[model samples]
Target: MIKLIAIDLDDTLIAPDGHLPEENVTALAQAQEAGVQVVIATARGYAGTKRFHDQLGLTTPLIVSSGSNVIEGRSGEVLRRRFLPLPFAREVVAFAQAHQIALRVYVGNEVWNNLDYDPSNGRQRTVEKQVEQMAEALVEAPFQIFVKGNRESELILAQFGEAGEGYCCRHHVYSDGISELNILHPKSTKHDALAGLCAALDVPQEQVMALGDSKNDLGMIAWAGFGVAMSWASEAVRAAADWVVPADAQRLTSDPDAEVAEAVLRHVLHVAKDKKSS
Candidate 1:
């Protein structure tokens, strides 16, 4: 039987404008009431995702920073953390600086960036500092580095071929034509973090359902027992999912009565109920 549900934040759970669909909110409450554990697995940091967690009243540990950090939701205690080596972090920063690309470095609870304002498309928890100052402040390894620009991720990958040997990289292109590059330790992935979470919860991988809509969410979608992809997801993401939600079900609208959330949750609830019955 399904015991856990891992949902992504952007596009999958919330509308493009960043509002949670009421249908989704009600569905999530119903799932919790049914005793199924729900957790958020997103590339967002704790600060970016905290509001939704609070809104949902989540008590489970949250998988943030694309799985580099997992913290207890209720107590705000760090449960697991993985960092990229200091040398790699330095190399990545220098490379971004040379390319004039905006980079955000996540170290513990603070987000360090060279830009005067948050460069991660309005993400929260940021502190502006010069690249040199940010590099020097890396007393320990950072959890992850995010690069934002119009450049394709493959270009960055090729440039870091040798330097990023031990690191893992993923990219997501937004609807507004901006692409983001995420650099992290090789072992830090949503799938790896989910494994750890499963271990802690005594739940098997086959008993979890994962929902997402972007390339960064591919790992978890493929790893989970039942993987769901949003209708507007990229071809690559749609191909990887076990099920694909229709566009009508995920309409891009400002309507408060939109049923995107309800459509997504109904499928999950049906599968969970079937598992229990079987």
Candidate 2:
């Protein structure tokens, strides 16, 4: 029996228009009622993921910042956090300056972003305090560092990623055609964080289900005993999934993007229904 579910938010659970689909809402509520743990695992901050946790009435810890930060849901306690080491973080700041690469750095709850505030363009919220000099604002080691643009830039971040400098890297592109590489502590993966949460909850890996759509989600999806990938996910991601949401799963949701509803309902809940009927 699947007892825990880790769900990615941006492209998997939330539609492009930014609304949670009606069917998804219903299915998650039913899952919670069925005593299954519904966890929101996203590459966003706690401030960004909290509203959904509240809406779903989930009491589980939230995996945020692509697993860099895990916080208790109800009391907002810091369950676990792995931040970039200060020396490496300072090195990153200097390197960004040298390459003129834009940076978004997280220092605890405060953020230092060089980008303009444009929520209309799908940018992170305006809560990020605009900073001209990253070195000046980065008082503490960052939980995550977002380097604008994809492709390794002259090995600036290779030390952290490919070179294995105690950090992990992820490449992601937004719907607006902008791409970024997120750098964080080496253990900062949804899979690693989920493993910790499962241990705490006493849920075996075999009883954990994970759903997602992006390559960043690949770790958790591949690690979960029963992994679900959206039908439109890349071939690599799909290959890792235990069950890829079929093309017909789109019909299970009014919002084409909330295919998670189908995975949750048919694969998770339908079994319960059948057992009761039997």
Candidate 3:
């Protein structure tokens, strides 16, 4: 039986502006009231995602920095962590330097970038504008403008290839056409985090329902018994999902939050309720 519901942040669960609609907020309350576990498995770190839990007034634990760590959202206690080996960490940094690509590293909740590539540099006026726009879009983001480098796409790929499961990488296309990449240790994936959460809660993967809308979310989507793709998810995301909500991104944005939340709630709650009834 399903005993837990894991939601992704970003475009899947939050508005484009980074705020949870009142309707979604209420739906979360209903899930909690039903005694079903409600939690988030996100790419965000503890500091970045805490506000979502707070906004919903939820006290459940959170899986942050992908699956690299599980934390107590309220107390900020790290319940568990999986870190990259020291050698691997150093290699990743070196690869970025070699390729002349910008790299952002997440060691715990802190982001470290190469000194020369810091986003604050006046030389990166174009990249800086994109960052500014994203910051405005999300209202809040985890990065704090650390070191930066020239675009080194080749080196970044090599790092991930050599690093293997030792680390994870996320590629983002900036509005300025610059590609920004982030790398973290292996455990920092939604799949691993979801597995970790299942173990902690004594819920089987077959009993979990996950919702997402991006490539980073692929692992968890495949890992869950029921994977939901948003209405506006990419074709790859839709292909990976067990079910697709007819509502795409535009529809979700234009439709009421309550409507979107209700669609998600019905599917997840049905799974949770039926397992118990069985």
Candidate 4:
């Protein structure tokens, strides 16, 4: 029987407009009431993810920064963290500065950026400080780095042989004109983090369900006992999922929030019942 449920944030749980549907809220509440551990696994930082955790009143630890950091929700204590090696981080910073790529570096609780702030960027907190001297400012190893711009610019970042080798890189296309490259330690993956979480909870990997909608979500989806993909997920994401919820079924005639809630509730009920009967 499934003992844990891990959900992705963007494009999976939250709508494109950044709103969490009421349906999803209710379904998750029901799951918690049923004694299943719910975990939010995302590429977002703690500051960005805190609101969702608070909204759900989650007590379990949260997987953040694409699994580079896992922290307890209520107590706000860091459980695990993987930081980029200092030399490698410096090399990445130097490369980004040389190419004039707009970059953001996450170090502990702070975020440093090289670009002007814009509300539409979707980053929950404002950049704490601007890196005037990228090299000097990046002395400490960062948990993650975000590079934003066109594909060509991100491709340029892929050239740092050894420096890039030690890190897991994810490319995201926000629009025709905007793309983002996320860098984290090679070991920092949702699957790895979930494994740790399961061990802590004394649950097996086969007793966990994961839900997601993007390439970054593939690891956990593949690792979970039951992996669910959203209807609008990419072809790769769909292929990785054990089940796919059709867009129409997810939304029905209700709002996106309600649709998500209903879909989650239906799936959870069926799975739990099946497990019990078997």
Candidate 5:
């Protein structure tokens, strides 16, 4: 009965080396051929995730930036967007400055940063503009804010205790082991974005399958009726899922990132093929 599949990108659909495993890619294509709409939901921003959308040749709306933004894949048009209030954005900038760490601010299609580090995933960013004044640089509300450090997220949460009341303050680590803090509007969750897509497509909550392996994917995993958690996922995430799919054994596939493909093939393709013949 599933009509839509929401798969997280980095760990759920592709490997950590950023490789899109052939089996995973092929499974997605087969699902689409069954008349299912597939969406890539990720903590990655639009710029970071666009290439995968292009490669998949998907036309469904993409849920990006931990659900703060959703864009039409085919035309690259913003479908839904949520931005941090200007006041909060300014406060976040000030906090990062006081901590002496780099800050990356996402504003619409452009990414502004106070660091020399390239925020570009693959797309080229214009010459880095030094943000001298946090208040001035953040005149416009930002879509999201990113800060990286060794467990700096804990500090950020404690510091913003009273202020970040409703903000989605999640602490997670990058592939390289550097911990990161993601700051965004309270409503910026993949669950919220995926719900919106379901409303648009007239797909019921019980007919959606979400697969993920991390905290960022927690929202959608718990919200979807046919939720799937990677066996290697954190205890909290696995606890929230209806089913926990194992990370591939060397026999099914050696790749760790493409582990969720098993869930798709088993749950999605089997049902679709059954429906076709019946």
Candidate 6:
């Protein structure tokens, strides 16, 4: 029987507007009632994603910072942490400067920006504004803002790739349809974090399932026993997923993002139940 469900937040569990739908919440509660562990794995940092956890009523561990850190979801206690070295961090900063890209740096839940000029990297520039908006929301919401960037992310990724995943490097496009730095420790990833959680929970990888809708989720999707992709996910994500969940029919939601997620969640939960019965 499946013992764990590692879900991605942004486009997987939560709707695009950053709220969990009623159907999705009901599904989670049912999963819990059925004795399945529901966990969150996302690129969001502890301070950034904690509110969602509370809203979802998750009692399990969280894989945050794209697996850079693992912590208790309800209590907000750190279980494990991996961070990039200062030298490597500086290299990433230098590379962004050299490439004329704006960057947002994340260091242990603190977000810093060195944008002398506004961001100028095509779609990434749009992401910069989303980052700013998220930061602004945090100020009023009493949460942490890890970092925001308005620099060339390609340059940042070039450096991160050079440094390799060994430094816990990750790069993902932000919500505004632009790329941003989603860097983390080399060993820190949803895959590694799930493995760690599995070990702690005495569950094997073959018994774990994962659901997601983004490129950053590829690792966990690949790691899961069943990797279910959302219907509205990017082609790249869909191509990698083991199965695809259809969109929901009930269109109570008006937001496009939330609607897509609700559809996926509704379908994926059905899939999960089918798996258990099978």
Report the alpha-carbon TM-score of model 2 versus the true structure: 0.86
Best by lDDT: 2
Give TM per candidate: 0.84, 0.86, 0.74, 0.87, 0.88, 0.73
What value does the lDDT take at residue 43 in candidate 3? 69
lDDT of 3 by residue, 86-112 (tens): 565565555545544444444445555
Write candidate 6's Cα lDDT for 1-278 as tens digits. Answer: 56788888886777666566676766677677777788889887787788878876778888987887789887878898876655555655555555555555554445555454334343334332333222233222111112234344555545455236446444556577655555555676788888889999998887787888887787778888877777777888777777766566444334444532343344434444344345
Model number with the top TM-score: 5
Residue 152 shift from truth in candidate 1, angstroms? 9.2
User: Per-residue alpha-carbon lDDT of model 2 for 1-278, expressed as tens digits?
Assistant: 78999999987888656778877888898898998999999998888788999988898999998998889988778899998888888788777766566677888767776555422223555635767676766677888877655543335546555435677667666775656678889899898999999999999999999999888789999999899998878888899999998876325445566688878887778744344355
| Better structure of 1 and 6 per lDDT | 1
Off by over 4 Å in 6: 17-19, 94-102, 115-151, 158-165, 247-278
**How well does candidate 6 match the true structure, expressed as C-alpha RMSD?**
7.5
What are the lDDT figures for the candidates, one per model? 0.75, 0.79, 0.63, 0.76, 0.79, 0.64
Candidates 1 and 2 compared by TM-score, better number = 2
Model 5 scores a TM of 0.88
- The lDDT ranking, best first, is 2, 5, 4, 1, 6, 3
Worst 10 residues of 2 by lDDT: 116-125
**What tens-digit string does per-residue lDDT give for candidate 1 at 1-278?**
66788988887788776677776877787788878888998888887788889898788999988898998887778899998888878877776666656677887776778655456655563555544556556677888888766563556677785235568777667877776778888777888898889889998888888888787788888998888887777888889988877655434333533333544445546634344345
Which candidate would rank higher by lDDT, 2 or 5?
2
Candidate 4, residues 1-278: lDDT per residue as tens digits?
A: 66788999987789666677776887788888888889999988888899899999788999998899999987779999998888877877777667666577887777877654422264554655877686777768898888766653455556753235677677777424477677889888888998899999998888888998888889899989989887777899889988887665423325654434544666664434344345
After aligning candidate 2 to the native by TM-score, how far in Å is the CA of 260 from where it should be?
Answer: 1.2
**Any residue pairs clashing in model 2, and if so which?**
none
Which pairs of residues collide in model 5?
Answer: none
Q: 141, model 2: CA deviation in Å?
A: 1.8
